[model samples]
Target: MQHRPQNWILILDFGSQYTQLIARRVRELNVYCEIHPFNKDLATFADNPPNGVILSGGPSSVNDENAPNINEDIFNWDVPVLGICYGLQILAHNEISGSVEKADRREFGRSELIVDDNTDLLKEIPEESVVWMSHGDHIKELSSNYEVIAHTDNAHVAAVRHDEKPIYGVQFHPEVVHTVYGGQILQNFVYSICHLKGSWTAKSFIESTIEEIREKVGDDRVICGLSGGVDSTVVATLVHEAIGDQLQCIFVDNGVLRKNEFQDVLDIYEDQLHLPVKGIDASDKFLERLKGVVDPEMKRITIGETFIEVFDEAIAHDDSYKYLAQGTLYPDVIESISFKGPSATIKSHHNVGGLPEEMNLDLIEPVRELFKDEVRNVGRELGIPEHFIKRHPFPGPGLAIRIISDVDRPKLDILREADDIFISELRKNDLYDEVWQALAVLLPVQSVGVMGDERTYEFTIGLRAVTSVDGMTADWAHLPHPFLAHVSNRIINEVRGINRVVYDISSKPPSTIEWE
Candidate 1:
């Protein structure tokens, strides 16, 4: 079990794509929230119940034969409850069978919500405002025990409330940004109805995490693998604060990292952060293992196993280390786990899914439940420098995955030079902090290009930059065309082995941030 805030909200997820978004919104209000599978046993939190409960939207329909159902025990807790999208339908189905059914036309986009009663959940929300709707099933008839609080033109039962209890439901998604009053509506529910104090701040998390780490680790030494990314840096600093010299950090060059990344990050860890760290250049070993590995999954697994081997060999001389700490985040865990059942694996993250089953040391992830932005917030509270805290997220497999082909030293060198130019230009143009993540992918496709009045065949580089609140969902950053032209010119002219450059304009649902 991990350390949790005293006043927190419990979000029961029914496999919604936006389940994490709901948690993010709640956390934005300064109230801590956790997402658990809908069928999770409530008895696990019997001693430490949440101040309130939120049912997240999902892709499942309540009328389905094997649909996810509501836990009746939630009512027994007597906590304020708010249901969203599919959550609202399930509640009505539980109250009265067959109350919800398929709609003639699926509502999949923005819709104006008309608030009829602005007493509780809809309190302070605009009388008529845009609300995001993405549901095929709607509450056709609410139970007699419930009253309609709000409605859209298409969805009469857009929002409903129980006659007596502090239970409410909404058909529209309040977690998405498309909903104009979404944040305010959630603020009302969490603050007004639930009476939560919104006490779960970065400082509070750091204080509790420090105490918990010390208690769990005791006098045993801990070894942490630093990736030079924000996540690992924050973890090392937080752990170092708790156990001081008891923690040992190791940063290895995997032969696929950005140019000068190994040494640059090592300097920050040792000099700037004052953490006990050792830098190892195991690029040759990593590159040897990755040679001829073309499949993305295989590449990830190879790098992960190679990383374990390096760490194990580095600490082989000493058996004092009892724990292995990583900077695993919430998205990594969510995307890695087949939480929705079999075939739910989106892609195996190097840190989360690439690890071997058995290891010599126990795993301790300090920020396992936090999102990328949340981790940055924790970094700021921990006194990490502002510039370091805002660094773009670097994948664990490094440029290997970005290569989009088999691993090799020549390919690594090409990618490193190209990526350095892209990143350096972003920083120089004052656009580094504008996007969430940006990288240059060395595509294997080669075409004839005219350079110095000569025809030459060279590799291509794909530029990808995205804007996102968290890494879970993203939209390609709309960088200026002139800026793009300038970066493209520099990459092709300065870096060798590159002919063409293309910009990715796809969003998360259609295309992920990374090509691989």
Candidate 2:
């Protein structure tokens, strides 16, 4: 793939949990960046060298016998460099004059940062600001040519910079939201030190993506599984533009959709997009197979396998379509392929695994390189309505995961009704766009309640809404009490079989956005 010259940043990942966020932050600045493994060969680096390079945070200790190491010549690549977290420790232990030592007290959360001297990196940052630290090691001895620019309460040498070179390192993570002025620090490095010209935009991405898709799927029929989410909608639109009438979208309603979402989405594809969309009603089939499954992983595997079966069966007699296009994002690919990050397998996405090898379908993932917000931007470029582009994200397995336990029609109905009510209230209060993703999870346990002076045993539901820049990390939405009370009351009173409700207040590091 060809790209514009001198507008990209090369980020080498060292297995940090926040590595993806670094790329997201740079992209948010409208500057292009690419991530490669920490041990990527020097030739790959020489082939398309970026204007600047970034060393990402990692979990491995620099003193470990099998620690990940980079090319020593990267320090002499002439391009500016920024090392973060473990990256800082690596530099201290190797290139610069500093000794890495395990801290007496490990810092795991927010801390106070005091700037000893305002350097180029901390140009406009406040003298006393907050930062997020998650390390058990710190720089004990500073190099002769390096100076401590900033320090936090827990770590004395929180940040350091080279006196002559454009190389800098920070012990704390600036990619996360908990760190104050994190974006500013990155902007200072990207724009001030590297002098990057923010030239990337959604329009240019769409044009290149469309042209690539056109060349890839030349005169061949493509079948895409449309889940009615922004990712798939935008992907379908892009592919449709590339090869008109050659793309046939199949929407499989596994009977686990939002209330009236099946028809609503079908209407959007037929009436609004004016494309060839086939709606497959496989609710009964799915429910029949999911009769007594309780484990979440099993549930996901079942849904994914069943979906592939449905798609294969639908296209068994019709053999024109030869490609299966999915809306698999970059994070999905990273998580599915590697177990090197801080967090382990939180959960398996339906599209991530469990497909039989005999399916014989070539995948044409148009938007796999994008994140959720980027997908929305592409949707806007493709002339999709703002309302559709802004819809909250929904998982591929649908209400099956949200139900949390054995599947049934009554449970699906109750969850769907409650989810619909919760979403309606969010939109009525104009709080939909403020959230990244929101959904109601149906708990397995039931609760006792008194309604109309009668004792009743009903199901309990949990409402989850989170604010996130990308789906990689999330913080629960701090919905107002009045709004929560209203939505809770509506769910308990209007929707039968759901009497009790609660809200999830956990962040992504501790809890995932979904219950299952």
Question: Number of the top candidate by lDDT?
Answer: 1
Which pairs of residues collide in model 2?
97-143
lDDT of each: 0.90, 0.85
Look at candidate 1 and tell me the lDDT of residue 272.
84
Decoy 1 TM-score against native: 0.97
Candidate 1 Cα RMSD (Å):
1.5
Error of 2 at 296 (Å): 1.8
Q: Give stretches of model 1 more than 4 Å off.
A: 340-343
Q: Report the lDDT of model 2 for residue 70.
A: 66
The true-versus-predicted C-alpha distance at residue 99 of model 2, in Å, is: 1.5
Residue-wise C-alpha lDDT for candidate 2, range 352-374, written one tens digit per residue:
76455567578878766677888
Clashes of each: 0, 1
Q: How many backbone clashes does candidate 1 have?
A: 0
Model 2 stretches astray by more than 4 angstroms? 1-7, 40-47, 71-78, 96-98, 104-134, 143-158, 161-166, 177-180, 317-320, 334-343
- Candidate 1: 10-residue stretch with minimal lDDT: 338-347
